[model samples]
Target: MEVGSTRSWDELLPDALGLIFKNLPLQELLTVVPTVCKSWGKAVMGPYCWQEIDIEEWSNRSEPGSVERMLRMLIARSNGSIHKLCVSGLQNEPVFSLIAENARSLRILCLPQSNMSDSIVEKIAGSLSMITFLDLSYCYKISARSLEAIGKNCKLLEGLRRNMHPLIMEERLSQDNEEAHAIATTMPNLKRLETAYLRYINTIGALEIIHSCPQLEYLDLRGCWQVKLDGEYLKDKFPKLKVLGPYVVDRYERNNDYEDWSDFSDSLYDYESSDDENRFGELEFRFYQQFNEDATNGWPPSP
Candidate 1:
């Protein structure tokens, strides 16, 4: 007899609804889930739903001002409890400073391709003393100075990734040993490190990290074209550490055509920034629509 009775979505328990929202990415929580109704709107407005703020997917769409405003709103909603943050593409210093000012409890920070500088890294070190994991992959502006800042300040850091900086790869191997030296000199607590595609980094830098980072457990040297390795030396030097090998290709097989190199570089830079000029409104809607289909299938939507 009660089969036809209907309950509104607003009638659902807040805790139950929050569990569903928690599984969603941060962008979806802020832009989509809160828009459903007043009950859900209030539910998602809480700090628990904003603990991890990852904007790498939407980095292409964010402007300096937009990112600042978005962070302000999210930080207020988070109430200073943010622990993990990942952002890419947005390069404004003030916005980054704002993050350091608010998320004091951050533990895992990923800033791949974000155009962050050494000074900014120092500021982060100065602000958050508890950061344990950091990702600086493709952050071309960061150098050994930034590493020094982190090593000196963030004593708890256990994992670090500094893969593929575009500018550094073009320079000579000897010119950029600052990063290796800085790590050896400061971060004695580091356990995991990734240095993929750093073409200039050689055996000396690798050896420095191996000797300096006493707690090293994982090391990724893939695509480090200049690092020559001897199995026996590596085994003897780092008996407890596990290491991934560098990219393998015959050096003599390389193409040295100047015009070809220039063309490749131009194409690479163009593809990297092609999405920067676009907006996120339509993309957000599409992401939301695709979720249900992908969720049921237990797979991500096609890119």
Candidate 2:
């Protein structure tokens, strides 16, 4: 292979092009890459390339109808082989139903910052039995019943993220006493979990989760102000676990007392100094990477 040699990418086989398409993030593959040429379009538009469909970034940036049409098109192209899907802001139920109807092999599903209901959860659970990872963070409408449905149906589920808006968290501080118990009892296979901004969960619930899910490797209870933990006790209880949030504040912060008590609507501009901002940046980056790691892997689309 000479450095100066001119090779024609147009001459590359369909399988080679499919491999290249497989490596790209779904956004790029759908919008930018396919427009290169007819041959490239033909390769990239194959169902193998549509295995992982992530359009979370398009949330609020485009109209719901437009997103739905795009999704429908991709669903058609996927030919029922979609393994991972992330659509954060598209709140149309018919489109969601279409996704459930088409993407039977879906392993990971993410719908953060979207409207969700018990019926929707039941719909998804009823269709996709192979789901292992699910993210419904910032979905304020979902209740404990929804969680129970997923736990009951998606027996293979290993990772769950269900952080809520801080205002809603405050409202449900007293109401969600039994929710954690539901999780601990039903979802025994859970390995990774993020229940951030949940003021309802108490020490009892947290302990229950730690004790029940022996396979738990990662847990994020950030902004869960009520749940208290003795670090050593947690360390002893779950030897394989790496727990994040207030419990590990001493390890990450200069002043462990300086808590990140934020409302869901506000940005980090309210922070007093750049140091505080920087700390939050690091924390957010770390959490985001972990949150998407499984989906962002070559196999699944990152939500």
Candidate 3:
């Protein structure tokens, strides 16, 4: 942090080097220090230190390219050992592709803001069969076809969250007549399920998700406005589901019409806390704190 700290860092041994490197910020650790020397470069760019990637922040919107390029670094560093990743609010398509393809070693993937599709999700399921935890909240474009692909392929899947901005993707799933059983039969391994922004969907889709993903110990339906919910149905269908939260957001924008809408206060926290303590980690909190409060005009209340 200072000239003296820099001098002390120069004197650290290989064992101590990782500590110093770990102490450095992610961007600085990956960028600035490598320029110092070959030893530092070789030491810093190893598989052990790069086993996991967490681009938990995309606040610096000015250099979106740099953030997208980090996906390359992450894929290369992962080298088939990457265990967990949480990339939120990304715009690049290649980043999504590389994440789905090269991260076959992943056990958990929490891409909250990726604008991905069923094809990419199919690729992920085909590649990363060992995956257990997956969250795709806020990605509204994803369809039931993609969900079908996810359920079919992720056999070991334990926990899943597939929330969306209901308004952003209202055009995707409008049918009140679609069969829900087909999608339900695909994902039978889910131990936890969280869905929101589901205004367009009917009880059939809700029943499909509930009946199919019976292993759920946790079920969250914050903003499932359209689905007819009842404790009896949930209790009968999801016997093991110990936690359930179904919510309705008071403020909403429909059909891209924000002209008459009054904005509600935004919170990084959605619904209520299901975990004993706050679910967010320190780095994750720091990340979200930077930029998560934009007035989302096109965002749907449920999907």
- Best of the candidates, TM-score: 2
Ranking by TM-score, best first?
Answer: 2, 1, 3
Task: Provide the lDDT at 67 for model 3.
Answer: 64
TM-score of 1: 0.72
Could you give candidate 3's per-residue lDDT for residues 197-274 as a string of tens digits? 545556667766776666655555545666666665555665555432344434321211111111222222333334
Q: What is the lDDT for 257 in model 1?
A: 25
Clash statistics: count for each candidate: 0, 0, 8
TM-scores vs. true structure, each candidate:
0.72, 0.76, 0.68
lDDT of 1 by residue, 1-303 (tens): 289899877988876776678788766787888788888888799876667776656654666567657767877777787887776665788777877887588888777667688888887778867888887777778788998998888888888877763234656455766787888888888887767666667789888888888888767665575677775666676666666546322110121121122122211111112242132112111121212454323311111
Model 1 spans with C-alpha error above 4 angstroms: 1-19, 25-28, 61-65, 165-168, 172-174, 249-303
Task: Between candidates 1 and 2, name the one with more favorable TM-score.
Answer: 2
- TM-score comparison, 2 vs 3, better candidate: 2
Point to the candidate with the largest lDDT: 2
Candidate 3 residue spans exceeding 4 A from truth:
1-24, 31-40, 59-63, 89-94, 169-173, 176-183, 236-239, 242-245, 249-303
